[model samples]
Target: MNRKKSIAHKLLDAIGLFEIHKLIAKHINQHHADIVVDYDLSLLRSAHLIGAPKIGFFHFRPKRFRNGGTNKLRRIGERLKHYQKLVVLCDEMYEEACFVWPHLKDKLLVLPNPVDLDSLLKKSACSIDFPENLTPGEYFVSVARLTHQKNIHLLLRSFAKARELGCKWSLAIIGDGEDRVDLLDLSKKLGLEEAVYFLGYQTNPHPYLAKAGGFVMSSREEGFPVSLLEGMALGCPIISLACPTGPTDILQNGKLGKLISFTEDNPDELGLAMFEISNNAALRKNYAEESKLFSQNFSSQKIAHQLMSLLRDIASNQRP
Candidate 1:
């Protein structure tokens, strides 16, 4: 009963939330001289239970429905007023949704999403074979869920155009979702069925990354793409839509890679850029170096230390 075990783990995780809340409450009580810390309130019932005058929200996603977001916002607003300190780690990784509820802006601390540098560096090699049918250096790699938000269609359209321009490039998309079938169909419709490969999800994509010549993203938006960071960390030349908050910041407003328009994208421009990058080995190497250097800012250890320092500062301020 693997399914039963999976179900059991889910049940345990759900139940453990209360235990974690209680433990945090206990710690707050024991350190009565300091502040309170609430992990995630979607599970915790009361702010008082966590016992901290200050709270840090990690990976907070505002609910979608109007009523839910409004209710959650009101609740958070109340807590913000009551709490001595309120900091939200709005890693804003997928903040396109936040465009709908712009009011949720001020509460965010905008921490960068962290990556384990050591682990990522360790995966600099790929084991997956370049199948006989595939041509080395003829494929572009994009690693993300096959979802509408990821704008897979734009990438497909761009690739199709690139192919029509006599550019020899295939696309290897790693990661799967409900959009897989539809995306496959879209590739076929665009006469790109043989040119694109959907490899589904891979727990370790570093191997694939190492063999890839470049990385691309057509997402409509993102806070900061971990995939982009990974590509940079692995020395793959990066390209992404000039989406909302993340990509531009990561690319330093096109300083790192080509940032194209999502609304009125010119495949001609994109294909030309790709064509140029394909031939320019020096430029590609330059981007690789830049990508690696840029990735250091998102290290997990650095974020953790910053978080600890912030917590200590809050705790000190809360000492009564």
Candidate 2:
């Protein structure tokens, strides 16, 4: 029944896409718009149907196999081909798209997501009704939707293992989603009800990241984990799964922080990584220093200009 509801929800979401895009198209027609900068991939078809020149920002990367990403590409092939240029968040994802749809090779461009460092860091200092037990520099933190894709289950279970191995680190995950109950149950099952804290969705999660001893991301997949970069900006040392399209570029292939392939990773391995990050002061300091350096690339002043320039160029071509 839950699965049926999930399918229905997705179907409704797809329908909503058409409805919303039609409205957007209607607005464009009303306003005499020149081009549509499409941010959501699901809306590409609508953007095309709207009869405006379309520039899509592609951020998702499904696993690349005949039955996987290829099939997804085929479903949207009509709208996909019509994009004036497909803006991807990173070079790696851009490369993957080019390989799948060679026809859109020239249309692909890499423009990573920008972060508001100053604003986020300020939020990191925000006074919130925090869990009283939480102490600055004593607990590891993560910010992700409580979902299978984000893999908080893996992080919880791994933290449990690390606990048994004599590490006394507490974990705080900030984000609310479908998997929260299941994760809480798992924490209880692992006897981590006390050690692990779920703060649910937070509007300003930076202060938690800023005060945290370190940050851990155990995601199974990602387009580009913006939360990972946010952690870096807040000076939180990190340990993350080397998922698609984000970590390598931001973490600089582990020069800035810990990155490993998590699908093949075991509880003990992840636990060990967590324990190491929590236990070592020197190592944490080094990663934090390197993280500060790496975060500058994603600063708002930087990527905002890149995106703006891309829009300017796209608009210029249509001029005259």
Candidate 3:
């Protein structure tokens, strides 16, 4: 039966993964590693056999943790025992993880994603074949793959609504993905052909970020978005949906920029925000200044130092 074949395939995968973990453990032992840092959940199993302390760096929001469903939480809890530390991208994720697995409290740590502010500033100064209609400090910009998760459709809908509300600023999206065709169709359907420009994937988006009047994020979910940070580094005012795990922490609870609730289904919320930012120069300038100043805290040097300090303490057998 098909069910039997599926089970057999899963069994093979489990065996293969176990062998890989054993090999990894052997390599760690041979190298006399001080600590092992893994990015995938599957690799945590290798920590059981490895003598060195292990740290798990999780990048995305786990469905189990998000929904608080008991289905796979127990399995995830079991995996946590193998690692001395677990690094999550945001404080919200840390709180959720501890809530779901209270016993793993001591193991959890919050480390937001870092950006090279110095290098990013340099790149932002580079010139590009700027769009004819798009003027600096007069348009909103977003950098994300054209996908359902990104909720670019929501962005287009909101842009249309903003136009109806008499907002004159245009929107320029810089990214490409599988959802491109569908999104383009939706853009046309929404009558945003003239106002909304799809620039596709750019090798260097920093220049666009620097020139943007505002940066917006409409994702349904994110794991400490680096694009938002890059926008802040470029001194762009921000407007982001208060999605899971990232925007709230980065925006410092809306002090740095506009943070909208994702639960509000009406397009008017985002539309009104876009309209307000576009019309108010003083507000934009204040938000831009705050954004740039707050962004320094997330520079690569500071984050690197914090990470090294944690690793050093853990390796030296001291709790951090």
Candidate 4:
């Protein structure tokens, strides 16, 4: 089930809770399915109401839990004792979950998010025209939903400053979301109309990923950061905000990619980082080499093994 910090969120959850999941859980249970992997926490309550054992697959850092606020998260964390297991995307999240509900610590599993490297390679081979006035291997790319949590506003401002500081690369953002209008407005406000190219949503952005000279992520927070991992898989050097539960772990604290501290509304740190990453060819070379190795750890085979093992354990422990 979804958990939110504010009563307003709780009200919203109550209004639009799960009629679909409830029906699907019934079908799965009737068919003798032993477990439901809860990708979206919105369905956890329905899974249990149907008497199906669930493995909570955490895809985002729970805002209330990650930032250490409110009683709502504690209630949700305490409810973890009822789940078959909790699969977190990184060690920091695993620890955070344990801290949230110490008694359910044994039920927590650390599984790095996996990417389809082969699919990326396949898509990269496809022909796609670059945006007008764009050059391959001469710009920064970011792939994320244009939402408040992603903080695309921070990215535009940093890019503007980086431009002022003589960084020659342009920016291409992939994906669309609620913040698109606001972010585009900010881009123009910062006088970045020519330097930034908003590509909207692309079904296969691998061509952009492959040709990118570097990548940058300025999210306010994240759980796993799939975009950053995809960049590494394609051998594009990266710079990211040191958002909890992902970037620091993936970048090995700046050994493979640059991680800047998140300063509220101030793009100075990330702007400086962008300029440095653009100018340093040797560092970029080393980062590219190191990131290639780093990307291997999130292989589908490896993560699938862990997930399968959890499934077996849950199936075996069921009280028939």
Most TM-score-accurate candidate: 3
- If the candidates were sorted by their lDDT against the true structure, best first, what order would they fall in? 3, 4, 2, 1
Better of 3 and 4 by lDDT: 3
**Which scores better on lDDT, 1 or 2?**
2
Q: What's the distance in Å from true for residue 209, model 2?
A: 0.6
User: Top model by lDDT, which number?
Assistant: 3
lDDT accuracy of residue 109 in candidate 4: 86
**Tens digit per residue, CA lDDT, model 1, 259-308:** 66654346666666666666677888888898889889889998888778
lDDT of 4 at 140: 93
- What candidate 3 gets wrong by more than 4 Å, as runs, is 1-5, 62-69, 318-320
Query: Cα deviation of 176 in candidate 1 (Å)?
Result: 0.6
Runs in model 2 lying further than 4 Å from the true structure? 1-27, 49-52, 62-72
Name the weakest run of 10 consecutive residues (lDDT summed) in model 1: 58-67
**TM-score, structure 2 vs. true:** 0.86
lDDT (0 to 1) per candidate: 0.68, 0.81, 0.86, 0.82
- Measured on C-alpha atoms, candidate 3 has an lDDT of 0.86
Q: After best superposition, candidate 4 residue 188: deviation in angstroms?
A: 2.7
Candidate 2 lDDT score relative to the true structure: 0.81
lDDT of 3 by residue, 168-268 (tens): 99999999999999889999999889888899999999999999999989998888798998998888999999988689989999999999987435677
Model 2 clashes, total count: 2
